[model samples]
Target chain A: MPQRIGQYTVATPSRPALLSYAAAVGNKEGDGPLGSCFDYIAEDTTMGRGSWEQAESMLQKTAVQIALKKIDLAARQIDLIFAGDLLNQCIGSTFGLRDFGIPLIGLFGACSTMALSLLNAALAVDAGAARYAVAVTSSHFCSAERQFRQPLDYGGQRPPTAQWTVTGAGACVVGHGEGIAVEALTPGRVVDLGIKDANNMGAAMAPAAADTILRFLKDTGTEPGDYDRIFTGDLGVIGSRLLCELLDKEGIDLRAVHRDCGVMIFDRERQDVHAGGSGCGCSASVLCAHILPEMAAGRLKNVLFCATGALMSPTSSQQGESIPGIAHLVHLRA
Target chain B: MKPTKKEYDAMTNKASPPSPKGKNSVFAFLIGGAVCALGQALLEGYRAWGADLETAKTLVSVTFIGLTVLLTALHLYDKYAKIAGAGSLVPITGFANAMASPAIEFKTEGPVTGVGVKMFTVAGPVLVFGISASMVYGLILWVIGLFD
Candidate 1:
């Protein structure tokens, strides 16, 4: 049974292990700073698919296959799979994993789907609800652009605060055996700060990220210094800066310990990724490709992985509704 | 103490870097001028080939739209547009791209619902306002003629 801590944090006494993980990314992401960290890089983003949506589905399928292959486990061996993507109806996950024959719980946390799915998988494993659980999430630049912003070939200039959607996918397998331990989890509340600009998602999500991180730290009785790294999912440049500023008001100095997956995934100056890499895959692939690998190598010990998400759609934005943001936290120790 | 929504928004604005407007404007100007110059050259060429003024003008537009559609199909227009910004956007070529991109992208959803419906998504507002404003202008001109 999971123990309830102060406010929203839940302590996983059993500490379910993260058994295996893998990441697959597109050419752009593969050319980035952490390019070598990924298990597979699709030189052709379409993966020879007829459409961008199908290409996105292929990314998810490839990620899950690589993850399961790492531990020599078949898809049937997985008890439950929690998966999601930035596509409408999460067709990326559904179409990709449908043939696997494993039961799946589809989530829709936008970019935070990676962390949200991971936290749920960890909790379920800890409770003995399933012998093995898999968490997976993905995003594609072409697919996301057509759905959220503009057509791929549309000639529009992106603002300085606009983040490039990462064309990648990540998958992780969780079980009770030996691996990185999932220690604690903090589920976030939907925080809306009246941010209406769709381009500035980092700013829109920063408040929720700060709120969740603060709550997690307070509930766990841990300082920023205690964790080797506190990773925020896809906050990019603006959100990362704002998150530090917001935490500073509470007398917590997070500047030194904080790292945003969005910021780390791309070389902003060289890649022309104005703000930084974003979308569900920005955090998902970074975790599987870089962060988890670093932890396994003994370079990192205790870490807080908080993935933030902007819960808004094109319809919602067009209707003049403000974007509501959410962030979920998971504490991992090796 | 937690800051109010207004305060937080202000903080966000303060933290975000401003867009490079001055540099972008220069690029936009150069690119937009180049596109216009190409159109003029094409018009001159058509006229030299013995076409009438109206025929040459129509040929210039047709050639530009056709070339834009081809570049869009080859996935080259967007790359140029990224650097050119408004240079590529505020032209006859831009309108062609606006129509062609969704047609290419949503073709997987089928010819009818996907390409046909989504074809006007981006340019629809521009078309709507353009036609509406022209109607208002025509109405004002009709009123003036009656007074005359």
Candidate 2:
């Protein structure tokens, strides 16, 4: 299975600067973590204001479009499409792809959806499910807010824990037989920490991600120090420390390279990126844009991306409980 | 010993199993079930209203938020939640009620962590389920693809 890193792009409902500002504001309370977190190739400014459903569709389409432009493959030529976004219906993905005429699969790993989608695409190619696949997911703060929190225009200052939704979308296409490929991967196993609070997704998701990354490294006969970088979807500042601490508890110390997409998106204090976690777009943009380009430029070699997500439910919460969380990994090699 | 406000807010979700009185449990159940029936009708009616699915969900959320807030103000949300159980849940309004109920109970936890965090507790489950389910789905696809 040739996992061609053919193309990647990011779509955000927030302007880059606003995202920057939000991140800075959020980070003032804490020391930040991670690298060029929210950087990506293309951006879509034309936004739709409706429910999360409507906004997600526009954002998803924007990302897929940019990725397609780079690959220049017709919709029919594409073997399959794998996508995810932070919407209830996977709206950004499904509706955006409604007219594309390709077999569609919608996924939602929250902030980890980008990696989750990419992992699926890689498997599709490696397992001979398809020749070429499109994978993308978007995060719209407005839509997310409208759907989950208050409305878009609802005037409220976000707390330190709240993250700026990258008004950006990211995507990449994996095609069989050539280009910078995803050659070897250690698929991540899911773990639940049973931390049901959604406000602290970083805490909920970190343990799961840490557990899986440890397992993948062990099962594959690989070491954490083997990769040039070990990264997760959105384990912001607080969760990132907890992850490192958790890893240490298991007698695995990753002194080499560990990073987080959430922690990387903005400059701390300057960007208000308190504790460093955003939606799926965080890791998607980093991997698809910064990391992939760095790999293409031969500045980087093998890397690991462990995407994590929290799993909670209204029924569970109303019943007065915490949420469960999980993580998945995709190791990419040059 | 009784719980403090913070402890109460935290433990409210972990309510103990009821210790029934000798004979009135059935009557209480019937009355509770009947009230739940009315709320359900209104919720279903709101659901059936002419609107986009997105709009309808928002309407439902807002309606629930409004109703829950009203109930919280009137000190009824906690009572209803106890009586209705799953009935209080199952609807998006339950999310509204969750936040407001905790706010009422834990107002002493200070404004930020106590009230703010409580606000998200209701919606917290949505994030958790959405994330976990998707990751599982992603894993399933990965495993299935290996077989293919």
Candidate 3:
């Protein structure tokens, strides 16, 4: 069983080695700063699918296939798969990974799904429940727009605070073997700082990220300087700044080590991605493609990867419900 | 930690990107006028081709919708709409965009469920109410004419 540290923190006694991972991105995301790190940059966003949702499903399928191939593990070898996406009922994951023939636990942590899936997979492996497990999540710009916001052709004007949903998929294979082992995990509470604006996701999610980070630090009895880097999920520029401010208020300075996947994924000044890149794919693809390689190369030793999420549906937003945010923390050590 | 006023001010003062603006009506006016001018030009062109006034009017409306859908597919209309603001919502083009945008966005769901279903999400309500109101008005007119 996974050891419970304090509150929501879990210490996985049996370390799980991340065997291999793969990422696939759409054309726009392929042009971002970490573009080349992705395993596949699909020329067609549709991936030969007739619809955007189907394309997203295809993206997840391709990412998992590549990840399994990287480790030379056939689909049947994997015991279980954890997958989710920013689609209604998570059809993106369900329809995408159906042929894998692995038992799946579909998850929904909104944009924070990447870390949530990772943490769960690590726990399953740590508990010796599965010999090999796969964790995957995806998001598509077109599909997300169709579901959460106005359709692309509506000619709706995007505000500067709005982030561009990354059109990509990322998958990882975890085993109770040698690799980057997960040190600890912290599940976030649904924090609501009374933010109601859906477009300003960074602001809405920052409090939750800060809340989880503080909880993780206190639970592990560690300091901000203990980790080489503290990576937050798609908090974008505004959210990152806010997180720093929130940490500073608690006397926990993260000036040197703090970095967000949102800021690192895109060149904000050049790319028209307003606040920054966001979505499940944002952190998932970045962590899988760029950060894991850095860990493998022995560049980053101990790192804190905190993925934040906004849990709000269109109906809830219409009902005037404030956006509730959650952040899942995973401690990775090389 | 309960921060003092000075510390709070210092902490929150980090430079970030500009916030969304609330005013852009002038740009909307200018761009909307330009869109309207294009429609007027199409109307005159059809008239010059010896089409009747009613036929020319219908052709102008159809041309505006067709051009809007084409620009939307080319991924240029959103940028134009962003700058134009509410100005781009000039009835014909705006309505066409409202219909075409959802259809194109949902096209990935498949033809029957994705496109066929969501295509009417926006336009369906408009068509239902529009045709119903017109029929009601026509019935009233006929009722009054029977007395004459």
Give the best candidate by DockQ: 1
Specify the highest-TM-score model's number. Answer: 1
Q: Under CAPRI classification, how is model 1 graded?
A: medium
Please identify model 3 stretches exceeding 4 Å from their true place. B1-26, B42-58, B107-116, B123-148
Q: For residue B98, give model 1's deviation from the true position in Å.
A: 0.8
lDDT by residue (A60-162, candidate 1, tens digit) is 9999999999999998889999999999999999998988999999999999999999999999998889889999999999999999988888777889999
For candidate 2, write residues B81-115 as lDDT tens digits.
Answer: 54455445555555666556556534445688856
Error of 3 at B25 (Å): 3.9
Q: Candidate 2: where is the Cα deviation over 4 Å?
A: A1-52, A152-159, A186-190, B1-148
Interface RMSD after interface superposition, model 2: 16.3
DockQ of 1: 0.79
TM-score of each: 0.98, 0.60, 0.89
Candidate 3: tens digits of C-alpha lDDT, residues B89-109: 865888898889878877766
Interface root mean square deviation per prediction:
1.0, 16.3, 4.1
- True contacts preserved, each candidate? 0.75, 0.00, 0.61
lDDT of 1 at A90: 98
How well does candidate 2 score on lDDT at residue B28? 47
What is the docking quality class of candidate 2? Answer: incorrect
lDDT (C-alpha) at residue A121 in model 3: 94
- What is the two-chain DockQ of model 2? 0.02
A-chain TM-score in candidate 3? 0.98
lDDT of each: 0.94, 0.61, 0.88
